[model samples]
Target chain A: MVEIIVCFKHVVDESELKVDRANNKINFEGAKTKISDDDKNAIEEAVRLKEKNGGTVIGLCLGKADARKSVKEALAMGCDKARLLSDPAFQDGDAIRTAYVLSQAIKRIGKYDIIITATGTTDVYSGIVGPALAEFLEIPQATFVSKVALAGDKVTLDRLMEEGVETVECDLPLLIAVAREINQPRFPTLIQIMSAGKKEVVEWKASDLGIEASTVGKNGSLVQVTSTQVPKSARKKILFEGSASESSERLADALLKEGVVN
Target chain B: MRFLVYSEDIDVELELVSAALKSQGSQVSIALVGDEDPKENSKTLSVAGVSSIFQIQDPALKDFLAEPVTSALEQISLEAKPDFVLIGATKRGKEVAPKLAVRLKLGCITDAQNLRFEDGHATADRVVWGGNATSTVSSKSGAVITIAPKANERAAGSSQPDVRVLNFETKTRSSKVVGKKAKDSAEVDIKNAQAVVSAGRGFKKKEDLILLNDLAGILHAAIGASRPLTSDLGWMPESRQVGLSGSTVKPKLYVAVGISGQIQHLTGMRDSKLIVAINNDKNAPIFQECDYGVVGDLYQVVPALTKALRAKTGR
Candidate 1:
């Protein structure tokens, strides 16, 4: 049986977020959070592989204390067991620190054939965590994977690149960062959602993982946020309000005047 | 002060970093990593403010597997100990930068559009929340940063620089590339197109893309799409998708049809010189960001716009 660990993050839904123009900060008050969008696909892929190959699917998440809900959500989606690493010290941890903490938790879990993660998070979207985590685990990583096939002890993946697709082959004990195009995630049924409460969720503090407090959170972060501001629009927003034909004529005229077209 | 810039090829990003370093009175050296010979590229790089070049070659590097590349760069950084390490924020760079940062135990900044030195640290500004916000960040010490493509103008210099070949041994890794295939639609280079005609979920069917194709033909533009049209419906090739996971384009003119302007899609095209959106939904988010917006069905609006453009240009 194959044992796989999938990692996800709980992120504030950006569509519901409001920016404070005067202070240049994001207003997350009263905002609803969800499992980061792409992580759903990661969890779904893990569950599907378990169904086919008959293995255990472990859900792992590292975030603030509020992220326990994300572990429940993952359980409802078919994760056999879930683990959460929550601490106040992790509040300001950046990608590098988060990857280190997650790698430590994976190590504590003991046995796993593969680690799956989303390509990037929804809010920050830096797309660096999985690769960095692979480094910490001393495992080979295949990122932006669009397709996956299991063959005995090796896994083959079709990786999406900027130019085209490349087929890559790697052995077990590998990490894969899957793109959103890889699979359609499943929605939990009402029964599954209810039963998710019965499943056990193990919560561990940063210290419980044997990581020193100074090396697992903001204190270990290398980068610092200096300031944040709304980007200014550089173009004049001109709307051509009318019938399709009328608007099309006006748009063409504007483009002509600007010499964007002949 | 000294700065190190590395890329698979000698591109505009190297010149941009070189110029920034030169303006700061810092020495700049470049490391070009790939299978290609550096003799010809050295000529152009030398004139772009590079004082020396290190050509690191290995057959395994041709595919840019993260393990070997990161190992090679780690070895190079150990010796150079540059004040900063800059890499182009391409697909490969995004994967390599973080691993290298972990190996070197340095702070890493990805997708940096602007960089500055302040208070004994390297500060970088990058877009967040798609393109809605920009965050400026700084590291406590020397950092690994990936420069956003086309973030600055290419620099020019007069002197020819010396080139050195570095023979670093690459460690063996488990992953290997078995095959490679060019996308069928690889010829449509949306990244460099002057004008782009893009479609969205408002496209009712795959065949409906013909209307967008016709409009692109009239405008001499490339055809692009929102994620669904490519990833979900396969109406267009993956190469034509424009979003956070797809290609980021900065064309001179971008005409969006039926795109509701999700933050992900906006990040890919919001930097265009001019934006025109045509959608039936008046409340679509695209209306707010576009220079010109028409609240009408793309089925009707796109053909009318195409005809209008043809008549105006007598094409």
Candidate 2:
């Protein structure tokens, strides 16, 4: 049996973010939050592995209390149980601090054969936490994994890279960061959704894990975000609505005139 | 300031070298990690501005796995004590930066677009919020940062730099490379294509993609897919997928067919020189990001556009 752990995040949907060009601000107020798109693949892969190898899939997340709603969906999608870290001390953490907190939480979980994470998150998209956590745990990691096949205590993975794919083999007690190409995340059926409430959801505060407050959150972070701005789009945004043939002809003519086509 | 840089790719290293040079009076050292002789790579990488090149070689570092690479970089970092550890933001760099930072008990900033030094601190601007916003991040202490791909011009230097070879005791490698497959040359490569015809969920069926292929063939464009067409429907291979998780392309001309222009998709191709979108909904967000937009069904617009291009070229 492979004891699989999948790490995920609750992030505000970036697509819903409204950019304020005049003020150079992003209005994230009331933006909808969900289990980040990439993390869903991690969760799904965990469930699939558990189904094949016969073990438990545990979803681990660190976020604000509001993230619990998203964590429940992880359970619905086949996490046998979940661990939520919603301590105030864990808020506003950089990747290093975030990984520290996650590593500590994973320590509390104790036993796990495999740890899974997405290539990156939707909001921060730093692509850091998984490898950092693996470092903290002193484990090997295969990032950008497209395929995984477990045999006994060894797992073979197809690691996607810019130039090509490399087949990798790692022993048990390894971390794998999956890409979107790895698997199609399943949408939970209504029955699963209804029953998820009955499943175990254990929330942990920073104190619960015996982590120092000074080493966890904003105060503990070495990097500080100074400012953010949305770049103004330079596109001309020319639009043509007409009969299909006419619109097509106009677009083709424009392409030629623009000198993008020979 | 002293800066240390390493990358799996030499081109990205040049970009890091350029970024490091931006800090006035900055001394940049490059770390070459491989089992092969570093003399050739060191010479190729020794731009005039670089102060030194460290050739780090060990049997355990034979492969590009994160564990050994992080361990090797960690050892080099502690010994060199650079003010900034700049890694090229390739797929491997993303994994290694954080691991190295945690090992050094430092913060890590990933995919930094620009790096500047002032008032005894380093600040980096990065695209965050899924490329919807850019955030300027800084560190109170020295940090590890991965430079975004192509973020700076390749460094051009004309000085001979000293090269130092360092060998570490072979550490136990946890992962092994069993096989490798280079991207099939016959596979359609949209990353380097001048033009791309991208499909989206609006594509009704797998066979309907023929319309895009026809259009792409006429325009000498490669085929790309929105996340749905590739991830959900599996209509196309993952390589052809273009989005946050897929290839980030800056083609000269990008024609998005039926893609709704989600922020994730836009981030991948918004930098294209020219963008065209076709969709039935006028209010589709893709319209805002496109240089030219047609508010009509892709089923109709794609075939008609193919016909129009075919007629114009008379091929």
Q: What are the Cα lDDT values of the candidates? A: 0.84, 0.86
Q: What's the CA error at residue B166 for candidate 1, in Å?
A: 2.6
- Model 1 bad stretches (over 4 Å): A20-25, B19-23
- Note the clash tally of each candidate: 0, 2
DockQ of each: 0.74, 0.71
The fraction of reference A/B contacts recovered in model 2 reads 0.92
Clashes of 2: 2
Model number with the top lDDT = 2
**Interface root mean square deviation of every model, in Å?**
1.6, 2.1
For candidate 2, lDDT tens digit of each residue in A115-204?
A: 999988988788888988898898888999999999999999999887789999999999999988898799999999999999999999
Residues A1-262 of candidate 1 have per-residue lDDT tens digits of 8899999999888787776767767777998899999999999999998989999999999977789888999999999999998988776887999999899999999899999999888877888899999999999999999988987889999988877789999999899999898999999999999999988789988788888888756678999887878866666778777788999999889988877886
Candidate 2 segments whose C-alpha is farther than 4 A from its true place: A19-23, B170-172, B186-188, B303-315
lDDT of 2 by residue, B1-315 (tens): 888999988899988999999999998988889777677778789787998887787767777678778877877776678888999888888889998888888778887765788865788888778667888899888889998777788998666877777777547447899999877642347888988889998988898788777888888899889888877788888788787777888889999999888867887887789999999999788887889999998889988988998899886
